[model samples]
Target: MMTRLVTDRLMMRRAQSTDLEGFHAVVSDFEVVRMTSSWPWPADRAYTKTRCVPINAAHGMAGPVLCKGEIVGIMGALSMYDDGPELGYMFARAHWGQGFATEMARALLDHVWAQYDWDVIKASAYDDNPASVRVLDKLGFHEVEPTIGTCKARGGDFPLRCFQLPRPPLTRV
Candidate 1:
């Protein structure tokens, strides 16, 4: 089964079994995964399938962000508290700085508020990832605080900035 999401400039849909090779190509690139997941490249299908697939599928079976029906990226929330969800995204290196991230972020927010009645959404990025910060800003997310967290990928602690997006009151109490 596949679900589709329409953004101002992109269409997101459920990732299919056929997308694994393409998904792996995008996520395993050094330029794409280096500063993002803290996971180094040449990732195998097992990890991507077992870990990434289940995580992305949890959002009502929605997969990831796509452009023109092609998988360009992935965006979704993690911890949804107080109707505020923790958001995250990753786009192919070729799609960087193309405004796709912002478009997808807005789409995800819209989906959550319209379908899930969410109040707010949160996201975090590495302290040095200005592009991601800019994307969140364009989507109306504001910096809430600095989060010092540990990612198993790096096998150590890391410092990242947390951003939050508050949905309009029309959809939340």
Candidate 2:
């Protein structure tokens, strides 16, 4: 499996059994989970270890983001029909505003661009998540359209702000 990445102030690596609880802490945070894309898992260890680890990935691989050694977030890509792959990320509340999300996004975008034939990398956020939109925009992604996608956290369709990028930005977050 693809593993660790080091950024300016972060160390992102593969998820581990030990990280389930910390990762779940981020999942339990309403603000973090609520502003994300698609299905959001409740804070459950069994689910996190059993169902989430094996399946919660962009392709067949994913790695969590750690700030100074704590599992503060995660990053990965989920491929779809003919649209290349979409990038996703979520960090814990205490870790916000620190550019960790942008740093991870920039790193993951670089990794994906190096290994895939993708013409684009897409991402989305709730319309109200300016921080998320700002992160994507800083990574050179632009608004495409909107979507009412499967949002397990909300238990139904939720509105999403879509953004797409042709390639990874040259800048490293």
Best by lDDT: 2
- For model 1, the superposed segments whose C-alpha errors exceed 4 Å read 38-40, 51-62, 80-84
Instruction: Report clash pairs, candidate 1.
Output: 84-120, 87-122
**Candidate 2 residue-wise lDDT at 110:** 78
Tell me the spans in candidate 2 whose CA falls farther than 4 Å from its real position: 38-42, 51-61, 80-83, 168-173
lDDT tens digits, residues 51-140, model 2? 245334446346578777778887776574476688888888898898888887777777767666677777888877789899999999
lDDT of 1 by residue, 12-130 (tens): 76555677766776777666665555454566667676434544433433456777767787666655234445777788988898888887767666766766645667778887678
Show how many residue pairs clash in every candidate, following the order shown. Answer: 2, 1
Q: Evaluate all candidate structures by whole-model CA lDDT and list the values in order.
A: 0.69, 0.73
Q: lDDT of candidate 2 vs native?
A: 0.73
For every model shown, what is its TM-score relative to the native structure?
Answer: 0.82, 0.83
Instruction: Pick out the ten consecutive residues of candidate 1 with the lowest summed lDDT.
Output: 53-62
